[model samples]
Target chain A: MYAFTYHRPDTVRQAAGLLARKDDAKIIAGGHTLLPTMKQRLASPGALVDLGGVPELKGIERKGRGLIIGAMMTHAEVAESAAVQEAIPGLAALAANIGDPHVRHRGTIGGSIANNDPAADYPAACIAMGAIIVTNKRKIPAEDFFQGMFGTALEEGEIVTKVAFGIPSRSAYAKFRNPASRYALVGVYVAKRGGEVRVAVTGAGASGVFRWTAAEEALKKRFAPKSLEGVKADPSGLNSDIHADAEYRAHLINVMARRAVEAALGK
Target chain B: MAAVSMTVNGKAVTADVEPRTLLVQFIRENLKLTGTHVGCDTSQCGACVVHVDGKAMKSCTLLAVQCNGASIVTIEGLAGADGTLHPMQAAFREHHGLQCGFCTPGMIMSAVDIVNRKGSDLDEHTIREELEGNICRCTGYHNIVRAVETGAKAMAGSAPVRQAAE
Candidate 1:
């Protein structure tokens, strides 16, 4: 790890201010991702503004028609939260399946969504559920928040405050994880809100996380595994890596989407 | 170097460390608590799993300075006060859960928190899924899972009765 100054501010405004003042400053949530990247010399920030101590960014609550998850809330918290489980069991189950117990305990949802790793599980849930990514400056729709691999629409000094997801009637996440890293090779989240169905795919895109529009259209009509049978997910822009090739990933997209629908339908 | 203080294994201690020093490094180098091992540079391996504020966490992913004033528990502190091994430690011994023991501490620590929080009614599938964070190159995870089930029963205070034989 490179030498850097560490600031532990108690409030979000103070932390954001510090981040704005320091050049090359990065916000540290659980440090599960950032620390490893720093250790590998992938990220060399001049300063680290620690958000672990920020009280404002750590909470989970049910508000109005949705659930509001604080940015600093760990995956374990989300997985174990009664509110999340009751409101959206699929989201809770998705959180429970991420990495492992230790990673779930320390890896924050904000960190996972912010990193926007194409293989991350949270982005798929966020996009499919149409959650709102609330930052210190504004609320970015999950669809617009994720730009590409390891990318997001977050601006400098803007910290993610919370994520809000409206309660869906039915939803589920299915992923074929890379056994080594437990990251999704092709993960899909299918959610049905009233008459409309939304499908989001992660880990299978060349440009990183993207929605499977064809599957979504079919699901919106039928919302069943058979509905996605003929829906051929275009592999034109899917990621091809050592773990899996583009063709295999496209196959996984179909399989995972179908399974997600099955899981959502309780089949 | 930065001045830091935290509660470790029920004792409050202070240390001066570099800003970039990882909690695992501080525990191993500064305090000489070498029970926590670093298996992988990335956070993928749970060999350095420890309990921070009563929850299992990968210490390699956290900064030493970040843990200042927080309560931390390591494998060294898991045993009973009279030097008796923890239930999980004893269960592992009985079940031969460890092959190399490199991953035992993290596996046990993570398992301890799992049963403590998730309760003893946990089935083998739940334990297996929860143990995904901790890796064991040897043993094929058969004994480790058995150890947790045995340990969970022991922790729940309703251990199976062993019948005396002639």
Candidate 2:
């Protein structure tokens, strides 16, 4: 890893100030992705603004009909949180399945969504549940927050503070993970709230995590796995790699989506 | 260079290190406690697992500077001061959990953490699932799973195990 200056800021204001002051300074929450990237020389920022010291960016609480999770809450914390378990059990299950125990202990929800990896689980959950990505400067809706793989609507010196997720009537996530890295080979998240239903797919999008509108439309008609029997995900823009070809990914998307719906229904 | 201060095992230690210096480097190089091995520095392999602030974390993935004011416990600190092995360590020896022993330290640390979080009565499936982060290429994980189950039971029978020095 390249040698760089590290600044540990105690507050969001101080963190933003440090980012503005330092050239090419990157925010380090859990440092799971950024640290590995730096170790491989894929990224070399001149300075790192460590957010681990900021107490403001931590905690998980239920507010009204939604859940407000602080950005710095670790994956382990989210998985073990009684609030998350009672409010949104599927979200807790997703958190529990990320990376592994050791990685979960250090990796945070804020870091995961901010990185916006194409294969990440949080993106699918956010988009499916219509979450709100709250940053120090503004609050961006989940649909507008993610741009593409490794991209977000975050501006320079912007730091994510928390994410607000509305508790859906029913929701669940299913993923076929790469055995080696445990990243999603093809993952689907299904959420249904009132008359609206959203189905989000991750790890198989050429562009990035995207909503499967056809499946969503079919499910809107009938919120059941059988409703998706004839629905198909077009293989055109899906990711193709050694792990799975575009056709296989498209096929798995249908299968995983059905599985997610089944899980949400406790079938 | 950055000056970092933290509690390792039972002692409070201070060191000057590069900003990029990993927590494993500090534990092994500066502190001269070499029990925590760095099998895969990229964080895929869990040979460098250690307890930081009462939780098992990948030391190699953490910058030493980030651990300032944190409490850390390596494999060397798991046993009693008089040299009695930790229940998990003893279980591993009895169950022959290691072949090359390269991944034993991390496996043991992770096992203790599992018991701490999930309780002592662990099933085989739960143990296998919880061992996801720590990879062992030897013993086919059969013996390791057995050791974890036995160790967890032993931990339940024993007094609340003291983690690191206060």
Candidate 3:
């Protein structure tokens, strides 16, 4: 890694100020992605504004009809939070299965969604559960928050403070993980609130995670595994790699969507 | 250079290191505690696992500066003051859980965390699934599973623990 000035700010406002002044500063939480990239010399930031010391961005609480999770809450905390399990078991399950125990202990939900890795699990949950991302400036809905892979609507110097998730009526996630890295080869999240159903597919989109409207429409009409009998995600813009071809991912999305529905229905 | 200070292996240490200095490097080079091995620097292999503030995390993935005020318990800290083996270490020795032993320290660190979270009453599947982060090419991981099971039980019964400075 290149030599860089390190700043450990205790508040989001202070961290934002540090970022605005530094020409090439990177906000690091958990350091799972940023540190690795720096070690590889892929990202050479002139300054690293470490957000690990910020206390305000490290909690899980209940607010109104939703659960507010501070941005620095690690994946392990999310996986083990009783409040999260009660509010959204699928999100808990998704958090539990990301990477591994060591990775979970260090990786944060904020960093995961901020990186917007195509194979990350949190983005699928965020999009499916209709989560609202609260930043230092304003709140952005999940759909608008994710622009593409490694892309977000967050402006420069805007720090994510928390994510608010409305308690869903029912939801579940199913993942086909790559055995070596444990990243999702193909993962699907299904969420139903009132009469609406939303399906989000991760690890397979070329541009990034996306909502499977076709599958959602089918499951909305009839909330059952068989309802998605012939539903298929478009393969034109899907990711195809050595792990799985675009056609295979399209097929796995259907299979995973079916399993997610079944899992959500307790079958 | 920046001054980084942390409690490692029950000792408060302060060192001046580059911002890019990894925690594993601080432990191995600065502190001269070679028990914590660095197998794969990419954080895939758990050879650099250690307890940071009571949770097992990859040391290679974190900078030493990030752990300035944290309490770190490495493999060397698990032994008794009289040099008695930790129950987990004894279990591995008794169960022959290692071949080349490249990943033992990290495996033990992770196994301790597993037991710390799930407690002593662990089933075989849970043990196997929880070892996802620590990989062992030798012994085919069968013996490691058995060792962790027995070690967890032993830990429940009577395992010597050093007082950690919170």
Candidate 4:
């Protein structure tokens, strides 16, 4: 990686101040993606404000009707938390399946959403479950938080503090992962809560994580996998890469959506 | 340059390193612990896996400066002062888990953590799933999985399980 100064701040204000004061500073949450990109010269910030030292961004607990997950909490913490498993087992299962054990140990929920990688699982779960992204500045709804591929509504020096996800009445996530990196080739998250049905598709979106309104509306009419049998998702805006073509990805989205609905109903 | 201090194994040490220096580089170059190998420059390989505050993490992916004041354990620290190997280490040898041995350190570190979390009740499928981070090209993971299973039981029988407090 290009040479850079590292600053470990104990609080969000300190971290934000470091970012504001530096010429070119980036927030280092897990460093799983940032460090590798820097090493390859794809990204080179003059300084890094490490969030690992901030204690405020590290935990998971039940608050009211949802689970309040500290932004810095690793995937392992979410997967293993009895509270998370009890309140939202589907979300916990998604966390457990991300990358491998080592990656999960280092990667954080806040970083995952903040980075907004096209194939990340958290965005799907966030959008499907109606999660709230609580940053140092303001709380943004999941739909408003994700703007596009590798993009979010976060501004410069804005730090995500935590994410609050309401416990869905029923939810399940199914992903066909690329075997090599274990990232979703095409993943679907199905959620049914309070007479509202929402389906979010990740990894296959050209515009990043998006809600499949057609399938969601269909499922809303009848909560069953067969409800989406006739609903063919358009392949127009799906991602096409070496792993899978746009047509195949669009086809898999339908299959995954059906399976997600089945899984959620079974739960 | 930055000054980082941490407990490695049972020893407290300090070093002045650039913020860009990786933890694997600090452990291998600064401390001369060569057991931790760097198979992939990227974080894809688990060869640089080490226990940071009792949790397995890719040392290659983390900057040395990020590990300040943390307790780290490398493959070299798995044995007793009397030269007795950790049960996981012992099981690897008995099960013939290594051939090239490039991935052994990471495999052993990840194996111990798996057992630490799952205990002796780990089944074949769970062992395979948990070992996903570690890649053993030589043995095709047949023996590595066996070693982890045998090691988990041996570790559970021998001492108080080290829970991952992190």
Candidate 2 collision pairs: none
- Which candidate do you rate higher for DockQ, 1 or 4? 4
Per-residue lDDT over A14-128 for candidate 2, one digit per residue giving the tens place of the 0 to 100 score: 9999999999999999999999999999999999999999999999989999999999999999999999999998899999999999999999999999999999999999999
What's the best-to-worst order under TM-score?
A: 2, 3, 4, 1
Cα lDDT, all candidates: 0.89, 0.94, 0.92, 0.92
Q: For model 4, what is the error of residue A96's alpha carbon versus the real structure, in angstroms, after optimal superposition? A: 0.7
lDDT of 2 by residue, B1-166 (tens): 9999999998999989999999999999989999999988888888999999999999999999999999999999989887879999999999999999999999999999999999999999999999988888774599999999999999996665545321
Question: What DockQ does each listed candidate score?
Answer: 0.79, 0.88, 0.83, 0.83
Which of the CAPRI classes, incorrect, acceptable, medium or high, describes model 1? medium
**TM of each candidate vs. truth:** 0.95, 0.98, 0.97, 0.97
lDDT of 4 by residue, B19-65 (tens): 99999999999999999999886888799999999999999999999
For model 1, state the Cα shift of residue B98 in Å.
1.3
Please list the residue runs of candidate 4 whose C-alpha ends up more than 4 Å from where it truly belongs after superposition: B160-166
Error of 4 at B134 (Å): 1.1
Ten-residue region with minimum lDDT total, candidate 2 chain A: A178-187
TM-scores of chain A in all candidate models: 0.98, 0.99, 0.98, 0.98
Tell me the interface RMSD of model 3, in angstroms: 0.7
Prediction 1 global C-alpha lDDT? 0.89
